[model samples]
Target: MTGTPRRFLVTATPPTTNGDLHVGHLSGPYLGADVFSRAQRMLGHTALYASGGDDHQTYVVTTAQRLGVDPVELAARCNREITGTLELADIDIDAFTRPDDVYRDEVREFFAGLYSAGRLVRRTWTFPYCAETDRYLLEAFATGYCPECLVGTCGAICENCGHPNDAGSLLFAESAGAQEGSTTEPRDVEILVLPLEEYREQFTEFYRRRRATMRPHVLRFVDEMLSRPLPDFPVSYPAHWGIPVGIEGFDGQVINVWAEMLPGLRHMAEAARVRRSPRTPAGVWAADSGFELVQFLGYDNTFYFSFAHLGLALAHGGLVEPTAIVTNEFYHLNGSKFSTSRRHLIWARDLVGKYGPDNVRFHLGLSNPEHQPADFTEAGFLETVRTRLHEPLQALATALAPHTGQPVTVRPETEALLDRYRDRMRRAYTLETFSVRQATETTANLLALLAARAAGDPGLAVAGLRVLGAQAAPLVPGLAAVIESRYAAATPGTVPELADLLPVTV
Candidate 1:
């Protein structure tokens, strides 16, 4: 909150390992979280960033059904694919633990701790049960018209209408799998709920404190919910692929994927911090009081990040809730949803092959849907890549070659330009409405200006090159590396370590 945050943390709504990750998946959480983390570290702050696969989402079970494999096999396969895509794009995260991996027991322990703290209020409510399957229906499988809105959605919530559905009110049931017990009659069952009514006082305080930092859309949502009687959120039911609820007498039930997911961000941060801290030994789940959290997510999950997760934190005690929630609007592909199952979107592997990672990153950063859903067209992508990354960066890179071999005196004007560049980038620290779009534009405009000044004066070009290299450390690391290497004989310092480019949907 003051002069240089000593420690900071960034977490995103980890991608579900159901299928291929699209550009939409990239820009919303992973890319932006990477940028924020990189920026903080570059500023000399101890920033630890983490995200992982949501391996237990019902989507994974559906995908497993589609692939004719078990959920474990599907999760392992997609987890690898997702991590590979991030590495290929050079999206750096300190920890990317999975619920199916080392973090599994830790996540369960986290829930147990919260439960012990009495943060969880369990009230058995009537839920849909498929007698033939002998398990409670949930998520996509408990599909029917939303009781409140009459829109089609899962028993939990409607993505189309944003209404939280009551499982007991669920109508027609559809099986998550094509197997015999998939289609079934709904029977009444019992499940656990996290009542927001209990968290109202704490949530109001959180809402008030976060008002300055939350995005317009995010703030509005939280405020509306806090202004009313907070609704009770169901947290557990039967699921074939997930953490067991662990509450006695609820033997067969599993924790709702969303409920169990609340602890993941903290689990990741603790895992990363312990490794970085010599005194803190492994297996100890200690809270990092020094590092406050910041979360990045799409607007689609506004309710969960704003309320469900925050409420869980207040109840869990000693847990650090998010200081800011950066919510980006949807990014569509060619005026349509980018659905992986439909195969109507650009794949990360394919995009990198076609545009080169840096070009793809820069173009997508500019096209980020920060406030509203923006359509991404092939022609638009190409033009953005050309006009943004190619033309200007090429001209600047060429000019720096001859002069950057030595530490030439920086021209006064170019030094001023360098200061302006740093200031403009620091402005992105306003997390609620970060603008990769603006950052990219700033790079292009500043580089063009610096080039013009340096072209006429050799000394100015050297300073310009240094500034360019440092600036590149956050937006496009590859270019900065080239600047550092090409001018190694002349320039005295290494290139600033920055990440590659970023993108999302159409």
Candidate 2:
């Protein structure tokens, strides 16, 4: 364990409330953040993992319309489903917040402060207007080829190249809700925009300090974005389905959902703090709070978390910027990206229900898509669980079944082995080079080694099992709990009872 303990307010990118979470979603920020936070706690630190449903995204409005339901009702239901799915997947989020009156007030105050400080500028921008839908084609309401990569993509951000496209900037833009061949006409309107070019120097200095630690792919994306003139990020949009901007001369506009992200995170953090300590006042986001911010997100959201959000925090005085940003690549299913619109994915709840949470978490962790796109196949998952986890665990249990209730003293050799494994885990869980896949592999290797020595050196095996239980707690929490309970008396350097054998299956 580290000699000094640190405090961390770890956050995952909030999932949009348009639909239920899928395995692809769980495999990215949610699972990664949970494991990282848990590992930090294991190292004797204070790590509060928090996130919530993105209830104000345009996707929610479009999905509600498609389903013939009220937008508020749909968002609420989806939020509940998302919270339940996270719980089922064993993601222990401290605060799963929903957009309430308090949230809205906080977001409004944050935006108003930025505007008053001259960080935001009012300008006339052109946006595509769909006559058929009688709405401006922005965000989820629009679809076109990205301006940079020329890949077919939705508005706002391109998942392929990690670039942002302003409304009406997408090539061959068309209304997503309109009939085939339906086109949108350009309409100019006054709105608030953040000219990112103005803060180029600040962003450059910030990224210069982070170059060594940030992921290569993420750094490449940032460098590519900084190579050109930064685009104007719209802060407000003309709409009626979201939180109203409430700024003068923008009566009909609402705050852009992307722009609301940083403030929303602050709100969630404050909420978490209040729950942890009732007397603690708000403003835990202050830079002097001593809580290092660590953000976990996917490659598609690198721009928002690393750049856009950083700009917002800097512009807002006294707010803390993220100290570390962890990103994962796309997790695919059957060689294709999981898409709710295409309905080509496995629901997280279904998998957890069928295979159990620990089994599912173990598979996802072993195959975590950290650097490149990783595919999820049922056959591959089943094979990994059977060979890598279940078989070895069962073998060890069988060999030690006869030794149940027997007392054994841990050996010096066992301490050295445990120390080596602990070192591996410390490396794997390091914030700068964190890897769930590596951590999972270390746990599996320890289990295999223990299984091999179960019969010959039962004392060493039991002691090693104790080490494995503690090490695996962060990755496979449910399994670790079971292991610890069964081997409760198998403490290192002491003669203790083995109690009972491991479960037949996990």
Name the lDDT of candidate 2: 0.85
Give the range of the ten consecutive residues with the poorest summed lDDT in model 1. 496-505
TM-score of every model? 0.87, 0.96
Residue runs of model 1 more than 4 Å from their true location after superposition: 100-102, 131-135, 145-151, 160-163, 168-186, 274-288, 397-410, 430-433, 451-462, 491-506
lDDT by residue (tens digit), candidate 1, 1-506: 33655666788788888886898788677788787777777777666777788888887877777778888878888888888888877787777777754566766777777767776666756555566545566776666777656876666766644546666665565544436545555454466667788878888887778787788888777766666687787777756678887777677777777877777766777666665554634422235565667888888678888888877777766676787888888888989867777788888877876666676677777778887787888899887776655655555556545543344555477667678887887776445446777777787777667657655665655566566667656777666666565555443632221122122212
Worst 10 residues of 2 by lDDT: 495-504
- Candidate 1 structure lDDT: 0.70
Tens-digit lDDT string for candidate 2 (74-178): 989999999999999889888889889999999999999999999999999888888899888788888889998999998899989889987767888888889
Q: Report, for every candidate in turn, its global Cα lDDT versus the true structure.
A: 0.70, 0.85
Clashing pairs in 2: none
